[model samples]
Target chain A: MSDQMTEGYITEDGRKIGGTLMEMKNITLRFGGVKAITDISFDIKEGEIRAIIGPNGAGKSSMLNVISGFYVPQEGEVWYKGAKRPQMKPYQVAQQGIARTFQNIALFEGMSVLDNVMTGRLNHMKTNMFQQAIWKGKAEKEEVENREVVEKIIDFLEIQSIRKTPVGRLPYGLKKRVELARALAVEPHLLLLDEPMAGMNVEEKEDMSRFILDVNDEFGTTIALIEHDMGVVMDLSDRVVVMDYGKKIGDGTPDEVRNNQDVIDAYLGVSHD
Target chain B: MFYREAGDFKTTYADDNQTFPIKFDRYRYYAVLFFAFLIVPFVINDYWVNAVFMPFLIYSIAAIGLNILVGYCGQVSLGTGGFMAVGAYAVYKLMTAFPEVSIFIHILLAGGVTSLVGVAFGLPSLRIKGFYLAVATLAAQFFLVWLFNKVPWFYNYSASGQISAPERTVFGIAVTGPNTAAWATYLFCLIFVTICALIARNLTRGTTGRKWMAIRDMDIAAEIIGVDPLKSKLSAFAVSSFFIGVSGALFFSVYLGAVEVGEVFGINKSFLVLFMIIIGGLGSIFGSFAGAAFLVLLPVLLKNVLVGMLGWPTDLAAHLEFMIVGALIIIFLIAEPHGLAQLWRVAKEKLRLWPFPH
Candidate 1:
C-alpha cells in the first residue's frame, strides 16, 4: 500500500532520493566563542537516507540538532521545501513534519510503550483541552483514530508484545526500537536519528538496519542520521557527509566518500592517547 | 476464572479504550453508580450526609482537581485552598448580588472566576518549577486567605467577617442553606461529583490528558514532541482550579452553609486535600474518592469508637484521629508510594491470575 503511494518519489532502484527537501546554507553554530559547526553546508533530498558520520566531537550531532530546531545556527539560512525556515521552537519544527530521536534514547520512561507513541501524535491531534476533558465527540473520535495510527506503527516495529509495558522497563535495544517507533508515529516528512545504533550489538544493529530500510521503503520518509559506525553508514546511507573539527570534510555516496583522502585521514590519521 | 476475558472481545477502539475495560470492573462501576443514585438518597440521613457522604464527595472533587495539576501535569501547587476560597467568595458575591439567579449558575460562574485566578497564580509555573513553584503557590494561598479575611467588601460588610449561604433551591427543593433537607443537599453535591468525575476521567484518558502526562514525565521531551509547556501547565491549573472552585462553592454554600474564610479555607485545608490525593493515589480518580472516604471515615470512626462507645473525651478522640491520619500518611508514603490506587491495581493483578502463581 505504501509502495504504491510512494511511487512518484521512488526511482527505479526503489530509492526515493528525489527533490531537495532541506538546504543548509553556510551554517555556523557557536557555543560562546567555541564553534560547534563552522561554515557547513548540505542539502538533504526527499525520501533518502542522509548520514552525517564523524568521530567524537566532530559536530555531526550539532548539525543534526540544528536541523531538528534544538539549536539554531548563529549564522545560516535553513531552507525547507524552497522556503527559508524561521526562528521557531523545537515543537514548532515537529509540527512542520520534522521528527527526531536522541543519541541517548529520549523515550518517556514513565509512560507505557503505547502512550509514548501516542504522544508523537500530539501535533496531529486537533481536539482542544475542553473537548478532551469532556471526552465526547471529536476528542474521543480523534483519540481512536490516532490510536489506530499508533497501533499500526507499533505493529510495523513488531513491538506488539510490550505495548502496555512502560518504556523504562525495556532493554536497551528494544528501547531504541521504541524510540524509532515514536519518531515514525509523527509520520514526519524528515526523520532525524542521532545514532540509532549507538549502544547495540551486531544482531541488534542488523535488526535496526532492516527496520530503518523498511521504514524508508514503506513510508518514503526522508531520513537524516548521525552515526559513528562507518560500516553501517556505508551500507545504509545513500549519501554520506563527513565532518571533522566542526568542518565538512566530505560529502558524496558511501563508495565515493570511501576513496576521498580527507575522509580517510579524518578517521585514520587522528592519533589516540 | 471469574476475572478472565476469554469470551469478551473488543470490536471497536472505544470498547477497548473504555474507562473500565474488564467486564467485572465495568459491572462494579455501574453497581456503585446504581447504589449512589438509587439506594443512598432514600436511606441517607443528616448525620451520614453531613458527617460522611457530603465531605467525601466535595474533597474527592478537589483532589481530582489537584491531581490533574500535581499528579498529571507535574506542576506542584500549594494554593489549592486559596483557589477554593476564590470560588467560595465568587459564589457568595454572585448569590448575594443576583437573588433571582439560579444557585447552579452562581456556582459555575464562581468556578469560572476561580479559573481566572488559578491562571494568574499559575503564570509563575512557566518560569519556575518543583519546590520553587510550590512556594509561589503557598504565597498565593496565604495572600488569598488574607484578602478574603481583611476585605470587608467580600463579606458584604457584615462586621462578623464571615460569609453565610442564603437559602437556595433547585427545582423547588432546597439544596442549600438552613431549610435544605439532608437528601436534597446530598443529591445536589452527588450530581456535581458525578459530572466532575466523568469529565475528569475523560480528560485524563484522552489527548489533553496525554499532553499533561507528557509534561509531567519530562517537560523537555514533551516540548520537543510538541507539547507547549505554557499552555499545558496553565490549562492544568485552570481545569484543576475550576473543579476545586466548584468544591469550594459547595463547601461553603452547600456543605458548610456558613464559613469563615481563614478557618474554613485555610492552609490546613490545602494540606488536608493534598494528603487526600497522596493517600488515595496521586493520579487516579478512584484514588481521589478512596482517599476522601478514608480520611472522612477516619474522624467519624475515631469519634464512634473513642467518644461514643468508649465514653472517652471528644478532644482525646480528635487528637488520636490526628495521630492516626499522620501515621497512615507516613506508612502509605513508605510502603506503597502510589497509595491505595497502587494497592487496588496489585489486587486486580492477583485476581486476574488467581490459582496460578508464576
Candidate 2:
C-alpha cells in the first residue's frame, strides 16, 4: 500500500505516513489571567508517532487536552483533515474517530478489566436501550462482535490473565497496559496517550514502547503521545514537538530536535536544580 | 465439586456472556423459574400468598429497578416513591377512563408514564452528582407525594383522597380488587416478576448495562471514550423507573387494592428499596432479589417468632426487627461491601475448589 501511491498521501520506509490528520494552528489557551498554551502550532501527520516532550508544567498535557477537545483553545483554529474543527464536547470529538488515554490511568476502578475495555466500544454500538434490555437480535450480535475485538486487544497487550480482574486490584504496570487496551478498543483513527510510561519500571517501559510501536505498525493508528523520557521520545516517535513554558521550542524528527540548541538549553538550564 | 467447570467449555462469545455462564448456575436458575411458574401457583393459598410470596415478588421488581440506577448507573436517586406514585396514579386514571382495556396494557402504560417523570427528574443528574443529586431526587419524592395528596384530579375528587382498584380480571379469573383469589393474584404478580427479572438480567449483562456501569464507575472517562453522560443517565432513569412503575401499579391494583399517597408511596418506601440493593449487592441483578427477600422475610419471621411464639409484645418485635436490619446493613457494609452476591460468589468459589484448601 505504501508503494501504491494514493493521491495526496505520503509514504515512508514502506509504511503510509501521510497528510495532516489534525492541525493545531497558533493555539493559544488561557485560564483567566494565566496562559496555559501560548502560540503553539503543530500538525500531526496521519499514521505517525508524534511526541510532545516537555518539563513539569510545560503545558504538554494542556496541549493534549486542547487536541482532545477537553479544553478548547481561546484563540486558534483546529483543523481535522482539511476542514476547520468545530467547538464541541469531548465526546463529540471522540465520535469523530479520536480516542485518548489519561495521564492518571483513568480506567474504571470498580469495573472488571473486560468491562472497562468494553466501554470503549460504546461508540460503535448501534443497539438501542430497549433492544439491549430484551437481549434482542442487533444487541446480542453487536456485543459478541465487539467482545471479539476487545479480546484480541487484550491478547495483543498480553493481559489475558487479568481479563476478569477488577482494575482496582491490578498493579500499576498492568493497569497502564489495561488502559492502553481500552484505548485500542476504541479502534480510533487517531490515538492520544498521556505519559503512558510514567511511574513504570525499565522492563515495563520497554514493553510499553514495543506495544506503542506495534499499535502504529499493525493498526496504522495515528498516535500523539506526551512523555518526558528522552530515550523513549527519541526511539518510539517518528517526530517530536518540544514545549517549554507553554511555547513550542522545537518541532521535527527525533535527531533534528536532539541537535536543536534551544532544546539542549531547555534541558540543561533547569532553575529547580 | 459442586461448582466444577472442568469439562464445560464456552465455544462462543454468546455462551460466555450469557446471564448464567456456568452450567450449574444456568440449571439452578431454570429450576427456580420452573418452581415459580408451574409448581407454586397451584400450592399457594391465602395465608402463604399474603404473608410471603406476593410482597417478595413485588418488592423484588422494585429492587431490581432501583439497583439498575443506583448500582449499575452510579446515580443516587431518592425518588423511588415519587416515581412509583406516578405509576399508581397513571394506572388509576387509565383504569377509570378505559374500562374495556386489558389491565396488563394499563400497567405497561403506567410504566411509560413513570419513565417520562423519571427522565424529567433525572435532568438534574446531568449537572449535579453524588449527594447533591440525591437531595434533588428527595425533593422530587416530597413533591410527587404532595401532588397526589393535594390534587383532587389524581384521586378522582374522592373525599377521602383514597384511590382504590376496581375489579379487573384476566382469562376469566379475577386478579384485582375484592373477591380476587389469592392464587390468581399470586400468579398475576409472579408473571410480571419473572418478565421484569429476565429483562433486567438481560440489560445488566449487555451493552447499555456496560455503559451505565462505565458512567457509574467514572463519568469523565466514560465521556472521553464516547459515552454520552446525558443519554446514559436519562436512559437508566427511564428504564429503572419503568420497572419501578410496573411494580407500583401491581402494588396498588393487584397487591394492596387501595392506596393513600402519603401512607403507601412515601419517603419510607424510597429508603426501603435503597436498603434492599445495599444489602443485596451493588451492580448485581441477583442481589436485588436477595435483598428484597431478606428485608421482606425479616419482619414476618420476627413477628412469628418473637410475638407469636415467645408471647412478646408486638411493638417489641417490630423494634427488634428494625435493630436487626440496621445492624445487618452495617455488618454487610463493613465486612462484605459487595453484599449478599459476594457471599454467594465466595461460596461458589469454595465449592469449585472443594477437597483442597487454597
Q: lDDT tens string, model 2, B16-111?
A: 888777788889989988998899888989988988999899999999999999999999999999988999999999999998999999999999
TM-score of the B chain in each candidate versus the native B chain: 0.98, 0.98
Candidate 2 regions exceeding 4 Å error are A1-14, A270-273
Q: What are the per-residue Cα lDDT tens digits for candidate 1 across B196-230?
A: 99999998888788888888888777887888889
Ten-residue region with minimum lDDT total, candidate 2 chain A: A1-10
The sequence of per-residue lDDT tens digits that candidate 1 reaches over residues A1-273 is 121121235443665466788889899999999999999988888888989998899998889888878898999889998799998888888889999998888878878999899999988899887777778689889999999999999999999999989898999999999999989999999999999999899999999999998999899898999888888998998888889999999887788799989988988895667
Evaluated with lDDT, which candidate comes out highest? 2
Superposed model 1: Cα runs more than 4 Å off: A1-14, A270-273
User: Model 1 misses residue A26 by how many Å?
Assistant: 1.2
